[model samples]
Target: MTISCNPKLIACHDCDLLQSLPDGEQRRGKACCARCGAVLHRYSRDSIDRSLALALTGLVLFLVSNLLPFLALNAQGRIQDSSLLSSSLILWQEGNTFLGMLVFATTFLFPLSSLLAILYLLLPLRLGQRPRFSIHVFRYLQSTEPWGMLEIFMLATLVAVVKLGDIATVIAGPAMYAFALLILVLAALSASLDPQLIWRRLDPRCNH
Candidate 1:
């Protein structure tokens, strides 16, 4: 029942001296090493509120990323553009069903599920109620997070754009950059968030 991989309440990163943190811990505000002034945990001031806003923003961006065309390429006076979902469908139509399904699940499903899970976990915590689906949401987020392929998708798109530039005129779509930034932000959000914090806020009785 390890709630965190980081066990030391306060530790000097340079010297490796672990100090036991005093509770209240300034209401879980911040813990610093007394010996070296190294920060251990800097608690977020408005975790629930900020997480909720980010989750909602992520949802909207996820929708836009799937709905709008990613990019347009014009070759020999013929133009082609595709949304994220459309690209998957195109792959399937071209007899690459496995790759299509992989792309769809990685680029769309996993990331969206992660965002929704964060929302599900945080929303109820904000209202001072235990989240009913806390465990399910945590499991969903943890399982789906690794499958998010937005960064890989961006890299692939870049390679395609560079290679296609020799044969066609390439125009980037609004959704393309937005989607990339969205992925980056979501990744940051996921990394910054602590499940223990959310769980504690949700259910104080749960063993950490």
Candidate 2:
């Protein structure tokens, strides 16, 4: 889960003991619970810049993935192409509205919005300016992070390509590669983003 929150007393999920983190920020390290000794938080330098670069790249790849042909099929010498958006729309046209909406929300809507939201919050901060509703938007992002289910979408697409290959000539499209890279970018963005670090930058009075 990716988030940017101001937390003073973090409760250990395993033991439910609320505790404070240690003083001094390092380039890379994890704070652990004193009782159960579980990992509390991780701190790293240049997290904002790293996350910003990855998010910007992700937004570009996401647009490419949705615009270009996602995949193509050649059956009986008849060629057909489909984009990521088309796939979801096809599901809707085929009376699978629920699944279509789910795919659209999880794959297209959630991921795009997440990247945009990150940019919205981070860009101003990067320029040494505080964005409007910093805390509110940051907190809201945390709720929507889990809904970006691109990994699941990728897994399903892989299975589909394999199964379809047995019948049709599955031609991987440019968007397919873009989508693959987009997934990796988003994954790295999540890991590189440090919630605590952002909280400190956003609010100096944090944990004070």
Q: Rate the local accuracy (lDDT) of all candidates.
A: 0.74, 0.85
Pick by lDDT: which candidate is best? 2
Which regions of candidate 2 deviate over 4 angstroms?
1-9, 27-29, 34-38, 204-208
The sequence of per-residue lDDT tens digits that candidate 1 reaches over residues 30-98 is 667777777655566466676788788888888887777789989889998877777788888899999
- lDDT of candidate 2 over 114-207, digit per residue (tens): 8888999889888888788888888878888888899888998999999998899999999999999998998889888887667767784543
Which pairs clash in model 1? none
Give residue 119's lDDT in candidate 1 (0 to 100): 81
Clashing pairs in 2: none
Off by over 4 Å in 1: 1-45, 204-208
Model 2's C-alpha root-mean-square deviation from the true structure amounts to: 4.3
